[model samples]
Structure formats: C-alpha cells, structure tokens
Target: MVEEAPYRRIAAEIRERIARGDLAPGDRIPSTREITRDWGVAMATATKVINALREAGLVETRSGAGSVVIDRSSPQVEVVIQPDVPAHAGGFHVAASPRLRRAGEPELNRDRVVSSAVAIADAEGLSMLTMRRVAADLGVATMSLYRHVPSKEELILAMIDAVFGENPLPEEPPADWRARLETAARQMWQSFAAHPWAAEPLSLTRPQLLPNVLPYSEWSLGTLRELGFGVDEMMHIHLSLFGHVRASALNLDAELRAREDTGVTNDEWADQHGDELEAVLSAAAERFSALRYVAERGFDYDIAAVFESGLRLLLDGVAVALARREVSGDEQVDLSVV
Candidate 1:
C-alpha cells in the first residue's frame, strides 16, 4: 500500500476521534498552533490537516472557535432536481451544474488571481483561503494558479500589499506630531478593520519587509524625528502605535469566526454564557471581590470605543514623557536594558 502523507495521517487521527464521539459536534478541534505543539509539525502541515477535515465535511471553520465538528443532526434544506424532469413536478427545482469558465470570459492573469484571492480572504478568514479554493472561485484549474502566483506565501504577501495600497497617506502631514501619529494610528486601525485577516501575519518582533507597510513606519518615524526624538525613541513610538492597532484588530478574525460558527455576536455570546460565568464568578467571589462586583454591574465592552479611549491615554502619557524630556534637557537614556 502507498504510504499516506503526514497531513493525511494527522487528519485521520482527528477523524477517528470524531467518529468515536471524542470530538462531539460544536466541539473545537486542535488549532494550527495547538497541532504544531502537539504533533511537532509545521504550521503548513497543520493547516493542511484542518483543510482536509473541512473538505470532508467533518469540521468547519468558525471565526472565533477555529475548527469545530459540524452538527450533522441539524436539518438541511437542499434543492433536489431530477434531470430531464418537468420543473412544475418538482416545484421549480434547479439542476446542479458544474462551475466552469464560460466562453469569452476574461483572460486569467496574475492581477485577476491576486484580486480573487483577496476577495476570498476578505469574505472568509485567511484560514479558509487556499490555492484550490481560489481557483474554484476564479473558475480555473488549481495548477493554472501556479502559473500566476508561485506559492501561498507570495500570494499572501501580494494580498497584504494590495490591502495596504488601499489607504494612502496624505501628501501634507498634520501640523503637530501627535496629530500626525494619531491620524496614522487611526488609519491603520481602519485598514485592519476592513481586512481583518490581514492583521494575522503582521508581527512586531520579526516584521514583514513589504514596501507599502514600510511607508507607515517611515511616516511615523519622520513625524517623531521632527519632534527631536532620538532613533530608539522614534522606533519605540512607531512600533507602540502599530502594535496597539494590530493587537486590537487581531480579535476581528476570531470574532468574525465565532460569529459564523455560533451565529452569535460578542455581546450575544456573553449573554448566552452569562449564567455559567456568574456561577463560576460567584464561587470565587470571596477571593475576587472586584471582579465579582464588576461582573454584577455589567460592563458594556465596545472594542472600538475602548481603542479610542486607550489611544488618548497612551498619547497623553507619551506627551507627558516628551514634555519631561524637553524640560530636563537630558540625553536619551538606554531603554534596551529592560
């Protein structure tokens, strides 16, 4: 017998668990990170495993929940058409048809492929995006895509650059450094909000060297440099702003996934789980009085509002630090020690 691929073996193990009732419907399966940790496999391998499960209809991608077993017991309404039968007999049943490119369709090109991939990522989370899926969306064979985009990593980079290209910075900078930074921060946040999946690959530690993303860094650093901040301070402030926006936007993918999986919003999820949450909190009330009190009072958590409020506080702190630096006239201290 031919040996199975590594990803197929991993997928088989999970599938066996689902069959044995170890993984019930609505129960989350191992995430890509979790799979990597447990199986000593690369992220790409884990992704392939999940994709296999998804194709088998055994698991589905839920925004916040990663992958979960599909509820097979749930009633499904599908149109069944008998070929060459009268439509009136089956109440206007539509025949199933293969998805294929029509005659005179627009020629497939690299730009068309990239745009289609972006549209897929925008609608579904990046986890759901694959070369096969993109090809299906574009009505082309999977291998045909390879001619345009060499690999998934390159495609993702192109997608990132495309989205960043959407929001161009103004020719004239804001009068003040703070205003310029704030504008830059908000613009970045909005871009993340628009393409929630785009935020995933961005890392503060090992940043992607994309041309479009570099301009934002240049703009922020330039703004701070004009304010007399040293190189280290400029880098820190720029990263701080980017990190805040990115961290906040990171939840967008999970939230969207969760919403799709459970058919509930963040608020709805909280409300649905409120009783269980209260019970757990009540048991620990003696040890966590503050948390218990806050839980009882009910907090209206809006991420955007919190981001706005926190941005103001962070900028205020920066302003205070800048003022002190100006007054003291001291040379920049080495913050690298921390």
Candidate 2:
C-alpha cells in the first residue's frame, strides 16, 4: 500500500471543502501560510496542494486577491477520476477517503511559486515576506523553493511583474492626450491602492525594467509624443505621474502596520490625538493662521479624494504649461506659473 504524498493529502482536504460548498465560488481559498498553519505542513507541500487544486479545476489565482474557489458549475472540461484497483492487480483501488490525488501529480513550477509569493505579499505587507515563510505556506521544504526562486529579491521582482501583468492595456486609448494621461494615472493609482507594498519597490530615479512596467512607459511617452512634446518632456511627465502615485501610497504600509501593532485605525488615532491637536492649534493660532483656519473648518482626510484632486490639479497645470509653450514657441516654459 502506497501512502499518499503530503501535498496530495492537503489537496484532497481542500477539494472536499469545495465539494461541500463550504468554499463558495469567488471566495478566497486558504493561502500557503494559512494552509501550513492549519495543516502543520511545510511551504513546499502547501504549494503543491494549491497546484493540485488548480489542476483539478477547484481554484484559480486572482492577482492581489490570492486563490479563490472557482465556479465549478461552469468547469471548462470535465475530469473523471478512475477508481483505485488492488495493488496485486497492477492498479490501486480508490481509497475510502475522498481527499486522495490520483497516482501521478504534476511537478511544481516557477509560476506557481511566484503567484503564491505574490498572494502572501498582497495579504500581508512585504515586510512579512520571507523565503522560509513562503515555503512554509506552500508546505514544501525550505530548500525545495530554492529550485524555483533563487532569492527573495528575485522573488519580489517576479511578484512585481505578475501584478503589472494583471491589468491589460487598452487596445485603444482615449483620443485626447489629457484624457489618456488621466486614465493612465487613475489606473496606476488604483493598482497602488490594491497592493500598497508595490509602491515601495518602484523608484523614480532607479526604475525597474520589468516586462509589464515598460509598456506603461511606452504608452505614456507615445501619448505625449502625439501632442508634440519632446522626449525629455514626455519622460518627465511620466515620472511625475508615477512619482505622485507612489508618494501617496507610501503611507499605506505604515498605516497598515500601525493599525496591526496598536489595533487602532487612522481615524481612531486622529480621534485620540484630537484634544492635544486642538490645544496646540489654539496656542499657535496667531503664528499658524492658515493651519488654525483649516483646523476649525474641519477636514475629512480621505486619501483617495486627495489623490484624485492632486492628480487632476497636476494634469491641469501640465495642460496649461503645454499651452503656454505652444503659443510662445518657448522651449522652456515656466511651469510654476500654472
């Protein structure tokens, strides 16, 4: 009698959950870490379990969302599992347990390893990510992961590429350059919002040259080129837009960490400090007239609203600067006037 592999056993249990409808369609499936924690398996084993479920059409990976139970009612193709036969007859019989995988299973691949890593970084911040941690989630031995990903840095780069690949570029961008730029900026902002940790790795000065990230630059530069902007100007515009989004997203990780450590949200923290803030503002009202006025009027401090407003203002200023340069035929327009 051949005992089932650890991964197969874990896969069988998840399959049973899906079959029982305990994991409804579109519901997030357990991640590698969650599986490891629950089943007391290594990361490699957890990865294999997810792979098995994927091969069996029980779950699918969602960018920044982790693995989700698929709608089994609409399976692309029906898979029929053969019954187990006796070992003496050169075939194994189906065991009484429902959770066993068939005789042969697919080997682990780089794609699965990267996707699992991305899921972990997305759920927790990048700080929580580690090679051993990722392996533990997958239920595989720590050493087994080295075969797929050489290092944590390489894994992070792969994760970035995977995230950028999630949203496909439009076949036809909006006709107007301003509209197109706005659309691109908003999309970038939304991506940062979804994966807060992503903003930290992306740098304006030291930009990464990943496959998915390059297209965004090409798209933005191409749009500006159509508007008669020089290459230098186009590149500046692209960097500015990306930098703005990244800057706004910088606080997301810190805020999330603060909440986790203190069990207090941003609003709660602000509320707790409100009395101290009021006393300080009142004491310095004469010197800080503007700050005091704004404080008295009250502010909602919504990050999304602020991001959109700043983006719109930035684009509007850029449009004005472009117009000035066009009318004056000046190669250098004083952008500060806008």
Candidate 3:
C-alpha cells in the first residue's frame, strides 16, 4: 500500500545511501520537509519513516547534525531471545535457559540477566560483554539493564560467580595437603579453560572474595596448619602460592587468542623480527647512551612454554617449603624465592 510504503521502502533507501557512501556517520538524513518534498509523501508519513529509523537504531539527532546516520562501525549489540514456555515448565520449575526482559513486560530477575550475559561472554570473549550487547540479548532497552545491575562492573562480577558456580568442587578431602592443593589447582585451571572470560575479572593481589574461592584458600591454610605451621606462616605460603598459580594460568586463554589473532607462528615471528629487535637495541644504545651499561637478559619466552614451566616451578617451590618447615633445627627455614 502507498500509505505504508514510505516506512517500508525508505529504510532500504537509507541503507543504500549508507552503502554507497552518499551518507555516512554524523551526516544528516533528509529532514521531514525534504522527505515530504522528495518522496512526495504526507507530513505524517515522513514522521513515521523517521520514527521507524530511530526505533531501528539507524539514526539519531545531534544538535548540529540533525537526524544523522548511526555509526555502523560501532560494535554490534544484541539482546537475548527469551526461552519459550514448554508444555511442562511450571512456575516452580527452574528454567534451563535465560529469560529475556522486554520493555513494558515484567522486569526480568537478576539471575536470568546474569546467566544470559555469562553465556554470551563464554561463547565470544570478554570484550564482547557490553551493556548494549547484553541488553540486545535480553530484547530490552540498553538502559533497562541498569535497573538490574547498577553498573557493568557489577554485571561482570555476577557473570564470574554464575559461571564459577556451575562446576562445583568435590566434597571429600584428600590424604595430604599437597594432594588437596593439587586437586584444587587442577579444578581451578579446568574451570578457567571452560570460560576464557573468567581471567579478566580476577585480580592477583586484590581478588574479590567470592565465597566459592575462599573455601579453596581456607583448605590451603588448613592443610598448612595440619602440617604444624603457625597461622602467620600458613598465610604467607598459601597467599604466595595462590598468587603464583594465578600469574601462571590466569592469562593462558588470552595469550592463545592473541596468537590466533596475529596469525603468525611464534617461532616465525622471532625468526623474521630477530634482526629488527637487535637493530632497535643498537639504536637505543646509540641514541639514549644509558642502555649499553646494563646487561640484557637475552631471553624471549614463548608464552605457552612459560605457562607450563611456571606451574611446575610453583609446585616445586611449595614442595621445598613443606620439607624445610618440617626440618627439626632449620633455624626458621628461609624459604623465600624457593
């Protein structure tokens, strides 16, 4: 119908203008007066067309630019589709998938929102976790998510908790402290491998005290205590070891992704760039006059290799610590840097 064709055909024209570079981001689309004149449409029809573009998030008005093209180069955001009601999904039954919150509908609860967010981050990566993207996934206005989460930081923390909670730790205790620590460490590593996004939210020195994480620490300290160590020594060993494990494994997923993105084998990069690296060092020595005095470590480690080596070294240090502490007259056992 000509009456409704303005809304239908106009969007296609706008999209074409964008593709052909006749319009670009920050360039204004035709005003209602221009649309009426050019399209030979009624005033109300032009208004409807413009409103449709706004709702589609294709254009926005700026003070100087008027109703300009939206930046398509900007990252895409999406809301999740709600799970359909099953024949037997009762009110009391737990929903297996996330439920999207639509505007003017009952606001979705926090867990559903967080669950949906975590699923997206898991499938993609941490950088994909944006307010606009999550809202689109939920089929709601971007601002609507703010009512559920005060900020994106809070949303990230919630996502970490949800994903971590999925793989619960084994209930039983191990025969020795070493065995227990090994089990816990392996579990944590595997859990991180499951969701590569988990690494970004965690901190080494200032970790958020998720109760789930605390249990592992408590178990670590308790094991030390059982080995006849005092609370002070226990804290030192446990915290230090935890820090080592985190440093070694936290960024494993990120490093792999980076390697894939660069699309150059680590060895090949080194081979081609080795001369460039030397040239840069020589230039720095000539230019700065301070670099020639210090000894260079002369080492470039493959990140994948470092990950495994660091893990082994940390466990070895822990082994040495346990041995020295158990010595009869070791004179306080200087185990630092072991």
lDDT of 3: 0.62
Which candidate number maximizes lDDT? 1
Instruction: Give the candidates in order of TM-score, highest first.
Output: 1, 2, 3
Question: How many residue pairs clash per model?
Answer: 5, 21, 7
Query: Model 3: per-residue lDDT, tens digit, 96-182?
Result: 222322335445678867866776565445664577656644546678888889999989888777766877678887876667776
Instruction: Say which prediction, candidate 1 or candidate 3, comes out ahead on lDDT.
Output: 1
Per-model lDDT: 0.73, 0.71, 0.62
Of 2 and 3, the candidate ahead on TM-score is 2
Comparing 1 and 3 on TM-score, the stronger one: 1
Which portions of model 2 show Cα errors greater than 4 Å?
1-106, 330-338
TM-score for each of the candidates: 0.69, 0.68, 0.56
- For candidate 2, write residues 1-338 as lDDT tens digits: 99878887777777777778899998988777677777888866776676566545466555566778766555343433323422111011233212222234345678878876887787656865777656544545568888988988888988888887877577799877777888888777777777778889887888889998787788889877766678788888888887888888877666765665455888888889989988998888898889878777878877788888889988987797688776888665443322
The weakest ten consecutive residues by lDDT in model 2 span 85-94
Per-residue lDDT over 1-338 for candidate 1, one digit per residue giving the tens place of the 0 to 100 score = 98767787888889889989999998988876567767888868877776556545566544445567777555541222224432221111123212323235568898888887787677557886889767645545689999989999989988888888889778798777778889888888888888889998887999888888888888899877766678898888888888888888887678876666556899988899999989988888888888889888998878788778878887887787677676687545232211
